[model samples]
Target: MAPVFAHGQLRLYLLSLLNEGPRHGYEIMRDLEQRFNGLYTPSAGTVYPRLAKLEEEGLVSRSDDGRKATYTITAAGRDEVARRQLDLGDLQSDLDRSASQLAEEVRSRVKGEAADLRAELKAAAREARRVARPAGEPMSGRAGSEFERQINELRSSARKLVRSRRTSEAVRAEALRIVREAQQRIDDLS
Candidate 1:
């Protein structure tokens, strides 16, 4: 499950990733895709501004490597990450519950088909990216179409998963698959 947030969860996730070492923007995003399986990955469009904000706040330090714009954590950022790590579990649980609740709603109302909590969680991530799509960028072509299609398929899968799910193992299996798929997408994009 992802961390619960109406927004800016990606910022926290990025800060947490950067706490490990200096990395370029692409690396930070790819790490998230790896961690979440493919169900979640932050985009450069989303991550870069958050990095800038952390820099402004003295949490992250910035160094331009020609064009790479490498980012590293400052003491304050590390402290922030430490504090947040304590609550990371809670955040993920809350997100899982939210997706479960969404699935329940779908099951009760729409042909008794539940949403897969796992897939719904991925849908949430895709929604975040959709919101982050830049102005004047057409949602067309290979990349955009692939993203949109994945979002739709995940939603469909989630609904089915939630409706028929009866075992913890099944849930875990589906979730693991979603995570792997999302991570693969990030790798391909990178």
Candidate 2:
């Protein structure tokens, strides 16, 4: 994605920066990185297209000075900048909330499937043992080894499930913290 969306609400800052004075593309990118303390030092490639999109959206305009083209904000762009804090918070909140719910749903489904697989494995093992047993072929040793191997596989699968669940939880937690605390900080600044 372009820095416009990756930086999320920072695009408003670009509009705000333009409100101060007309600036070239590099200037806008530099100012944003400075303002955010390098949280997002946008690349020229990303910023230029984003600027073009903003211009296409009627949020900004440009002028040529025989060298670098300077960009300026329109009234619509100013309104957009003014509303940035609230809109950004809402977007983050919605996204994080959705992630949290989805993580929980995945965790529940995996747990249910694990239970079903355990039952099926036990039934299959039982049926196999009952139906086949060569006379004095020493099936007991083979069955014991197979049982151990299957149990190890189950254990390995459970560990992977645990790791996946924990990783998702960690991501959801970070998103929630950003949505809650970062929103408040931006609101205070605005």
Candidate 2, 20-122: lDDT as tens digits: 8889998988875665444346788868887888899999998887888989999998888776857756655654554455546656754565555445445
Report lDDT per candidate: 0.67, 0.62
lDDT by residue (1-190, candidate 1, tens digit) is: 3332457566676777787789998888787666544445566777788889999999988898997888999999888888888566666666567556655543354332223454466665665455445656677676677777766776676656545644334465656566677667545543
Q: Which whole-number lDDT from 0 to 100 does residue 66 have in model 1?
A: 90
Write out the backbone clash pairs for model 2: none
Off by over 4 Å in 2: 1-8, 38-40, 88-190
